[model samples]
Target: MNDDGRRTTRMRDRAAGAAVMEQVVRLHAQAPPRSTLARALGARPIGEDTAPWFAGALGEREVGAVLDRLPEGWSVFHAIPVGTRPDASGAVSDVDHIVVGPAGVFVVNTKHHRGQRVWVGERAVLVAGQKQPYLRNSDLEASRVRGVLAQAGIAAPVTGVVALVGTKEVTVRQQPRRVLVLRAEQLVRWLTRRPAVLDAATIADVARLFDDPATWRPVDSSADTVERFAVIEREVRTAQLVRAGWMLAVALGAVAVALPVVSVLTR
Candidate 1:
């Protein structure tokens, strides 16, 4: 999502294959399809190898779609850049999404871990069996945004959120000290149900501050799409391999069980 209130457009683009799709499209447009060039660039058969990236992009999009459904008073910003400027490399680092409205300002961090169990503690989070700093990172993101807005004379309360997308189970062992963890579907409900703490005028004011590039740092719009694509490709490949390994393990366990059963039946 670009910083110009084009969340829906961005989401639509991402869901339609995004950068990888763009690469493929460009290659096809060539006089003779540049199969070699595309392959060299890590474009595979485009099934499992690319599913993860598309899935993740779609996850953010799903949340964005939900945000789109909010009432007129709400202002949703997707792909927000917070804290520092596009780093030493001149690329924009993004906060997944943000919602500003009567309820207050919410820093929405979307996680796309399909079928994994999520455990939330007062200070940490665990996805499947791996420790993730989702809450801590989200808290820092929210704080950074708060600081930026405060300087603009808008001191609206900013809350951090970790919205799990397609997760199998979510257990809140204890509420995190700073961030609220919930499923993506529940996100909109929770936000809409919050007690109103800001008025329409203040919400509009806060939205204006975020819309200004000065609130964030120098934004490097160039090459951001390419960089994002590269990252997505890597994640897709990794997710494919992980799923393959899990399938292999499950198949081997099934074979092992069947072996003993077959032996007993023969006797």
Candidate 2:
């Protein structure tokens, strides 16, 4: 997915959809409608020229739905912008998902493709006639996420996960190491599974950080791209109120004591 798509995916976390998501919702409502649009923006639609784009939307919706089901406390972060790292050609990568918590940091790659055959092996996800090197990329992503967290002064283990969305047929030959494969329905369980390495305190800390929108990032997860404007409108009017209430009381006490002393001196 492109950058705009990633932003739409994160918007879903707010239980709110952007213009593109609204368009998709409208498309869903209208049947006998432009089936072509569905092909272009939904899950894999056969013979659809923009199946890739539609599949991407489906992937974001699926992944977002799964992450949403987690209990209120579990912090789920998507499409984080890590600092940067060099690739084989010395190009730095901007990885996809970063789930940071006590269970550990997880790097996730969301794949939305439809086909009759699919297999996830040691280093590749084979779907129909093509293959995506998920293992290698996910490992690299995990390393990058770890490095980013380290820069934040937090030491934690990192894992990789692949979230697949699409109505396409899928079959796996073997489970890949350090990677959790999941569909939309199984997201919470997949995420909340006992960690192999991270301690509990660190996990809670990671979750806490994600709940704050201050550090949240916006990125595209769907194929349909859009111009981005990162504006957050908050209603909270936080100020130094009750925290200074004690000081006000202290000043009043001083005035009360000084008044009596001054009256006696003047008289």
Candidate 3:
């Protein structure tokens, strides 16, 4: 029970990455065990099925880390499950983050495309020249959040934001019709700069409403989830380092061979 005498589930800081991390855990569990040789060679432990989810988890974590730095008077919720049932992808639809501040409410959708170029238009988002439904998804999430707030008798405006993570560059041809597109690093600054629309009392009310687990869908989460993901993340990073070392060794060997050949030819 919280101070308001309402029962609530314990929330973690990494709630933003919970959904994707759950997906990674499930997919990793289903994949066949790797052989000793494969493990030693640093072959990807996460299969193709789990890689995307892992990447997404990392993206959400990055965004969450930044959101954590928000000054006082701002309230943030991560991974708010909005869907009553899992979609065809076997994943529940969730808002990556919900932020309520003096500026009003924001529905954040996190997209992680490492080292990829992102172009945002008035109604479209292109990642590596391929169209993504980021804008549409952001709008939908905002709408859902609005509905939830309305049910609670809170009539604050909800803004949609698409936060791009790990992108090589983010180019906005034009802001989306109903959404703000920004790189993850720009999110906090953009948010803090927004003019205040809600006062102290309203902000506190909305924050309490969001803090109640009864306000969102029923989902199971615990500290264990974060710990489990941390283990997997460490393994993945170790494998990556091993692979890089092997590549470096191979490149040096090739250079060494080429140097000897050049010496003989010159002599």
Please, what's the RMSD in Å of model 2? 22.9
Q: Tell me the deviation in Å of residue 98 in model 1.
A: 1.0
Per-candidate TM equals 0.66, 0.54, 0.94
lDDT winner: 3
Which TM-score value belongs to model 2? Answer: 0.54
> Using TM-score as the measure, which candidate wins?
3
- The alpha-carbon deviation from the true structure for residue 257 of candidate 2, after best TM-score superposition, in angstroms, is 99
lDDT of 2 by residue, 1-267 (tens): 443443333322442123223333333334244255443333222223222333554565567666667664456665454434444433224344555544667666777665445676655677785787877777777776666567567777778887776636666667787676655456568667755466667777666554443343433343432222110001001112332554688799999999999999999
Off by over 4 Å in 1: 1-55, 83-91, 220-267
lDDT of each: 0.70, 0.53, 0.87
Better of 1 and 2 by TM-score: 1
Instruction: Tell me the tens digit of each residue's lDDT in model 3 across 1-267.
Output: 545555447333437788888888877878898899988899988988788989999999899999999999898888887888887768998889999999999999999999999998998899999999888889999999899889999879899999989999888899987999999999889999999999999998888888777788767655577778888899899999989999999999999989989999999
- Which scores higher on TM-score, 1 or 3? 3
Q: How does model 1 score by TM-score?
A: 0.66
**Candidate 1 residue-wise lDDT, 1-267, digit = tens:** 456644333221222223333333233233243266554444443444335545656677778777778877888777665545444423345677878988999988888898899998898899987899897789989988888787888769999998888899989899987899999888777888999999888988888777765555444333345455555457448656766776788899999999999999999
Candidate 2 has an lDDT of 0.53
| RMSD to the hidden true structure, all candidates | 8.2, 22.9, 3.0
